[model samples]
Target: MGIDFLHKAYVRPSTYTTCIILTFMDQITYYGGLFFMTWATFERHLIIFHSAVFNTKRGRILFHYLPILSIFVYITLYYISVDFFYPCENHFNYLAFWCGFICYMNLPIPTLLGIELIAHQVVPMILIGIFSLALFLRVIFSRQRLRQSIEWKKYRRMIIQLLSTSTIYLIFTTPFSLNPIAQAVGLPPMFTTPVYAKVSTYWTFGVPICVPFVILLSLPKVKEKFKPLLKICGLGRVVPTR
Candidate 1:
């Protein structure tokens, strides 16, 4: 919710209070989710393929938290520095708040666009793809090494869930991630088309909307938990005919 709010703040007009809220929330949600999810994928890799390292106290602490802390620190410093170099107050643009800010920054336009593209899309996509492929390969090799089909069956559902989630994430986020890059690479009309902006908005916000449906579909366990709540709300009754 906070992340979406910050995204909205880019196009919406902001007073002082809202600007501060957006500034802080943007850093936390944008960087927080990116770092956490990426690290979680890596942790899953360690757990599945190298449990020995994952079980160690030092490994647990380092893998579990060090990346998050580093990201938090980096985000804090980066935003502070961006604001210092390109103070929002001085270069405010209610029409295109974030785009304006980025273009007005001391950094070269290409460098700024490249940084955004790498940070938001390319890097995350690469990390997810690599980790997910490793996971798939681990599953295959584990089956060969264990020689007991039942041994890996228990993890099948989890593997499916991860792969499906990652696929959906990439599908939904790729266009938005590529938008600026597209604009930079002689595709300015791609974004200028009114339909593209609206479609992009839907895709951007559609991710969260789709996630719950994905979770319910991917994990029967989630549906099981939700079923009882639905029954409590009188929405899970079955009709019978005599």
Candidate 2:
């Protein structure tokens, strides 16, 4: 009875308030979902790419360096944006607000927001689309070769995990990508469209929580395995498995 009373008094309201705040925050920040999706993608890519290489000290150092390097590059680009591509005062319209919301959240603000319509939205979509297309072509053309060299059963789980992750990431990002083009041509706000705002906001919260759950489900042993992997990669001392 005490536990139940405490739960009712504290937990429920806290959870409800958190949900409302997150929804409002997401609504105000156009690219919040996309930025999170990009971060997730980058983390997953690092894990996959360095899984083999992380066995060595030099490789582990390099693995650590990549994210740092990415940060430096982002900073440099921000500097360039501030110095060179300053947007006109009249450019910050309703469309620009949405784009700016996305830009400011992910980037340093004002400067990055200035060029975000082109650099963040359009360029990224084009690059991601091209990369995805190339991956698809490579998969289709190389299937026979892969069949001979790859261990189908062992890799099957990893492949499914990767595809599921990619699909979810793309779903979250696609709307933000397309929103720029739509806004450029003077379409209504994506949220203002029937049912889209609510649906998209739900997705914003759902996708991150969903991906971790999916990873847990598909790789049932991930939590157990990851501790050992971290130790093996010299990230920390191994915790003993029970």
Candidate 3:
């Protein structure tokens, strides 16, 4: 995000090739996060409620590994086809963010992208909310029943990760997702469009900013991971305080 910002804010008359790189990356990172996180949130159900399904090798592959791999492959192939192979003459606006436009917009196939927008962006937002809340409720019910279905301490991070992820997506991504839907329906372009234009700029920074910290904090022994890098940079030794 920072690299793209620098390219836009500093570099003048950006080339079409650079625009392709910046725009493709911007689309993939932002949408990819939404898709991956949505699946992760839903996968929490399988990890908790459907543990037996993962007991077999086929089950593990079918339930867990395959979906993740599919998402990765799909995101890569879909965007590569769109940005690189799709034949559309692009007019680069060096003054605008990401050269000011998506190529599909110039073509008549933008409605197709809108369907994808809803499928990839809006649907994921809904699923994330539904499943995140369901996860909390189920855990609490299991605790009350005293079933001890799973060891809470063993999987404490899973719950924390789900809740944190839910919070991040619901708060940060909703406005960006809504921008397209708002325009798709009957409405004036100027009403909420300008606000989203500015929001869109900072939206580039939003998830990348929150996700790294969320991930690092969720990891086991995260300080151990960072200490060597800190030492390399001549920061003071990381020590435990009494």
Rank list by TM-score:
3, 1, 2
lDDT of 3 by residue, 117-189 (tens): 7888878988999989998898888865745667778667878977986788788777766766766774556
What are the Cα lDDT values of the candidates? 0.63, 0.49, 0.76
Best by lDDT: 3
Question: Candidate 1 residues 71-122, lDDT tens each?
Answer: 7787777666764455334444554534234323435446664576567565
Q: Which residue pairs in candidate 1 collide?
A: none
Give per-model CA RMSD.
4.8, 12.5, 4.8
Off by over 4 Å in 1: 1-14, 84-108, 147-154, 183-198, 212-221, 225-242
lDDT preference between candidates 2 and 3, better one: 3
What is the C-alpha local distance difference test score of candidate 2? 0.49
- TM-score, prediction 3: 0.81
